[model samples]
Target: MPTLEPSAPPSTQAAEKASRALTIERLQEQAALARSIADRLPWQLAHFDLDLRCRFGNQAFCDGLRIDPSALEGRPFQDCFPQDALPALLPRFMQALGGEKQLRLTEQSTPGGAHTFTETSFTPDVHDGVVRGVFVETKEVAGRARVDDLAQNKRRFDLMADALQDSCIYFLDPVGRITEWSESAHRLHGFSREQVGNMHLADMAAPRVGEEAEIGIDDTIRLAIDRGQWETRGWLKRAGAEAFWGQTLITALRGDNGELEGLSCITRDMTAMKDLDRVMNDLNAELDRRVTQRVRQHTVPNKDLDIFTHSITHDLRGPVRHINTFAGLIAEELGENASEEIRHFRDAMKRASQRLNAMIENLLTYSRIGRIDLHPERLAMTNVLEGVVSRLRQAAPDRQIQWEIQPDLPMVVADAAMVNDLFTRLLDNAMKFTRKVEPAEIQIGCRTESDGTCLFFIVDNGAGFDVAKASNLFLMFQRQHHSLDFEGYGAGLALCQRIVQRHNGRIWLDSTPGHGCAVYFTLPVETAMAASGLAALGC
Candidate 1:
């Protein structure tokens, strides 16, 4: 067996270096071919470095500027134009060096003693997230038609930006300096157009806490360049006022040649929503803290936990009752004069209060199930199931149902009252879920286990659910199906679970989506194994 060495041999190292050199040589060849193509183009093109000195010039550039090709390279931009033109041209070039693209339409005097309209554009040369130089493209335009079209489109966009009230839209140069500010932006940011000119967008950002504060405008610009757009939420400072929560969307605008031209920034004030979210988070934290403290102090019997639940629920009922009473009073006062919209609102209020009251009642019921003493006896499962089904049929008399009951079900030692409540909730669930079925079918059966225990199941041909979500089914306030399809408080299974636990039994379910489901539970048939009286709960 040969072992691999840690370091490469000298021959392998030489081969890698040769491969890299070949790749670089190929790239240089491609660059030269591109330059040759640019030299032949009719449009004048030149490159200038950060020092404002020309680095390269094509044939057209030398002919248009009337400068020798040899002298053009390494010459200052100021010497290329006439003395009078420098005043107007210098500022535009400066903006380009600062990462802003510049476009100018000027009338220039030709050597033939004639004036011609010229269109010039200065595009920044950015490399590796740094501004290296600028590329200048120039051509003579015969008429002013192109200039008129550009001016008209600019006006239309300005009008559109001004019309927005709740949102502010602004434009930035390629390097994130403010280039265009609208009237709406002025009102929202408290900055006039003159004040915002050449200002970096990051100046308006409010001081933020935590790690997010470390991310600056340059980071956002780079992200937008990579992803085309970026969205974030943070505080934006307003002049002479408190900072507001702003939801900002930054989009990178690119030219036809895939070069970054500018950025479009839109920010919407979201202070109210931010405040509401903070309030909710604080309330949740406080509630959790109080619940934790109470649990720690009352680690006694189940009776104490039930009393605590009852006391809190009792306090909550006062406000809900007030809302219900006031809503009814308002409706009665309006009487026949009330409009349909007002009446609808009044009814919605009533429904909300009623639903809240029902939830509280269910909570109380769940809390009491474990506290109350259990009376153990040999209870007949068949009779318990029959009574529950009879009440459901009476409640919904119009519905047709098919019942399948296995006769002579094995008896189980459990609390008759608790077992009856358990069957009522489970049977009621089967009926509610099967509301859409043509003929609802329910099956009830029980079998005696080898360990002297009875296993019972209730199968319903109803709207089923994925068996994977069974863990949440026994939790309070968890519903597998939508309430609009079938009405439920989401507490039936939780109550059933509580009852089964009190009797020292186990409960589980199995189902296939869109078909049906079966709930199974085990109860001890032997009296010795049955749990009786008040039992200490871990909860």
Candidate 2:
């Protein structure tokens, strides 16, 4: 009977009571875990009720104010913050209470009067889509360490800039306002750093006194930002209304995030060099006039002209070599301490020297081409082409090239070395100009002309120049495109022309801009001397 009564279904109220006790135990455990985590965090954390009374404070938050966590709770916002800071922080807290999150970087003074920077965030505590209170978290940013590092970097930059005698370096804000003027800059421009501070970069431009119109500093800054760098040679204003010819280089400075932060400008006083250049140009023009007159009068023989060419190149080589050597020495002396601007100047010197040296070497080669005697021999055009193409292919293994070479090309009597050089130069030119083309197409073929000459043509889909400029295509130092667009000293085509002429062949080119170029040259099937000699031998 007792067992039957006990089975009277366990009371629903008793089952509910057990479940409620378990839930309360779990909630208390979760609350304790959350509080422990908040205390362990490095950031200061706190919560404020809608009435701006502190409801909760983590260990870090209480430690900052030198108060116990429980003691800090129930305190008003005004009591937690300095009276002066309340004006700035109270509105931000109100914003968060209204469900708007707030973030700010602030510099605050400690009780010891030391200033520190902090990044703080205020988040709205929401429940069922309603704002309940504001939760605040803050972290110190080590402002003192960052300030020291910046000072060190600035000192290093100043030391490097002051070492350059002929160049002045300055820095500009993103908007081209002068921010830091170096000692060298002050000395060169005769303007004190204080005078130049916050001045627009354009203010340094000379008053356009009898000079041609040039790009404004505003345009220069824009171009520098767009292109990473911009350089120009113009007159720059100095103190006392004087101006000096200056070579200016503007390099856009970017942050780690690839954002334009500012610009570094290097201006070299080139007034002396500019005057020297003008005098040299006048002397060169006079020398050319005299040389032309002497040639027309037969006073300067061909052999003498060759000697003069060699002598001039030999004389110029010494100074170019000295420039390179001194620049290298300076770079070695500076070693790792060489700043970016100094390295830039040194590299510029090296590049200019190298280019001039290359021009001289090519000139020597061109002179030798006209003097060398051709040894004519029979050559299979197909075999010559294969060897040339193979070498070119190896040099540019990554290029995707489509070759449309004609099979069984005709044999001709020509100098083996000269023919090889001709193909190498023409093909190399084709590859260079077509560098941007995909699956670059190059065709090589030969056909018998009506005049009984072997007419060979090489074609490529490449960047071609205006046909009108073709007349000077074979002249030394004449180029249809700027060196910046295409790397060349304008010597390759001139050498190719000389090589063809010495072999008694004619070369010409046909081209249109953006289309392509086709080069044509004629060669005799057999040399007249070789044919006559064979006949006399009764072959």
CA lDDT for candidate 1 = 0.82
Locate the minimum summed-lDDT window of 10 residues in model 1. 530-539
User: What lDDT score is found at residue 326 in candidate 2?
Assistant: 98
Q: In terms of TM-score, how similar is model 2 to the real structure?
A: 0.42
Per-residue error at 435 for model 1, in Å? 1.6
Q: For residue 369, give model 1's deviation from the true position in Å.
A: 0.4
Give one digit per residue, the lDDT tens place, for model 2 in 111-179.
Answer: 996656677778999999999999988887755787455556656876999877989898776668776
lDDT of 2 at 107: 56
Error of 2 at 27 (Å): 99
Model 1 misplacement above 4 A = 1-303, 527-539
